[model samples]
Target: MQRILEPGQIEALASRSVPRLRLPDRSRVFAARAERLGALSRGHALQGYLELLATLAAAQHAALQSLEVTLPNESRRAAARHHGMPVIPALGEARSSAWRGVLDALRTAVAAGNYPPAVAAACERLATRSAEALDAQADRLLAVEVAVGDAAAAPLIMAALQVYWVAMAARLVADDVGVPESSGVCPVCGTLPVASIVRTGAPYAGYRYLHCALCATEWHRVRIECTQCSATTGVAYHSIEGGSAAIRAESCDSCHGYRKIFYQEHDPAVDAVADDVASIALDLLLTEAGFHRASGNPLLWQSPG
Candidate 1:
């Protein structure tokens, strides 16, 4: 199955003249929060993450100022040698200094053999800084796109954050929503799901799962069915050595598509993007099995067809 959108077609569609989407107020807010979180997450070990987040937030806000339309090339690669590098790493000496501080704080807390409020406080402070930086960068990107008449850029950037925020929010609220017997669509976001999980332990066992792409939430999909074509025949599951039984990729011969599933009992901290990045081998295997992904990741979308 040809799951990915053809780049040339997408580019052609983007080039055609059309009215831009007017993002809703709620979407704008969600975009801001999501951008902030993304930057903060990037700087998990560096001090400048918070600043990057803030820059991204500002970019969204600025984009909203111009009728909620984003600039084209918002997703474009930077021409500079270090374009698209997260601001935290780009901060050079500042990043190193901040990392050292974080390490020292963590070390001291560990040696104390007790949770240090200061360590947590410091982390929060750094997160705030990253958020600020992201806001600024976001604003700059919006400004540049608008000035250059590239309407596509704003939406691309906003879309990236929207996906991230929705995933995070979905995860936080997954349990509240009832799990289905089988399905791949997110109950909350109504977006195509990325993975499914078979959890172990009481109350979670025997239930099949689907992970959301936008909000990063996992919900239950009915077991033994193809998420794309709803066909059960020829469905197969595979895993790598040392892989958690809770998580595996479900491949559908009928549709020639596959999605990843995660069992909560396997590893509680399994983030869709982070874990997916780490499990490229599984993806490669699925590809070899004549299956392809139905959705795209911002990081992986650049792959050649």
Candidate 2:
């Protein structure tokens, strides 16, 4: 069994120079998460699938190394100044020529990762989609956590766009208009959050931020507030019998929604995405109690019953 660290023990760790966000170093994160997922798969019900995901994540990391996206400062601000504006251009909103590059990069990532022919083909289909089309489709799918399970290509498509958008956003947002804050959905992309992060290292230590799986951005949300319903009451936390102290689920009674939180101080190895995926037992237990996930991990797909 994995050792769980106590929360108080985590606070004792030193601080960092500044608060941290997860978007900038996309490749390193992907690589480390893949490694961690491989380790986590050693003895689990989802071992085969987890292992496959790790391989795919590694491929994404490699693909990210070579892909460069630069969003114009003007375009970024145009989207940010309005509440309804999307952070990145969607299908038809951007020209086909612009999307071709991302599609090419995704195809390479899929092929390099050695995904099956079906997955490769799926990537190709995603590649051909105009930014407007992808934006529309993803917006619909992300509206409900359960919707992702219906599309086999969902994971691949999300991963590819995540890399592309994060890369450009990291560089562009700094010089553009600031993203407006949203209580539940991501300020950057209007997507629901996948999980919250309890940061590690110095000055950033212990600060909490909600992590977006689609674009890798982190936005601040108070630790005490319910991520699902923004409720201050009836929020609860749960952990497995003997899992690492690094991860757990935060559930809200007000909306019956649950989200994973990664407290990285006690276990610096924790990641919002990888750790969330590895903690399937917590999801099952939470659901058994009537809570449901408010957000979806792009790497996971569920089949509708």
Give the candidate number with the greatest TM-score.
2
Model 1: lDDT equals: 0.45
Write down the lDDT of every candidate, Cα atoms only. 0.45, 0.68
Score residue 243 of candidate 2 by CA lDDT: 82
Q: Give the alpha carbon lDDT tens digit for every residue of 105-223 in model 1.
A: 32333233332465344334433444345444434432323232222223233334443333224223222333233344454334555566565555555566565544444454456
Model 2 RMSD vs true structure: 7.8
- Expressed as tens digits, the lDDT of each residue in 27-70 for candidate 2 is 57678878888888898888766776787677667766777665
Could you give me the TM-score of model 2 versus the true structure?
0.77
Q: Which stretches of candidate 1 lie over 4 Å from their true place?
A: 1-160, 163-183, 200-205
- Tell me the TM-score of model 1: 0.44
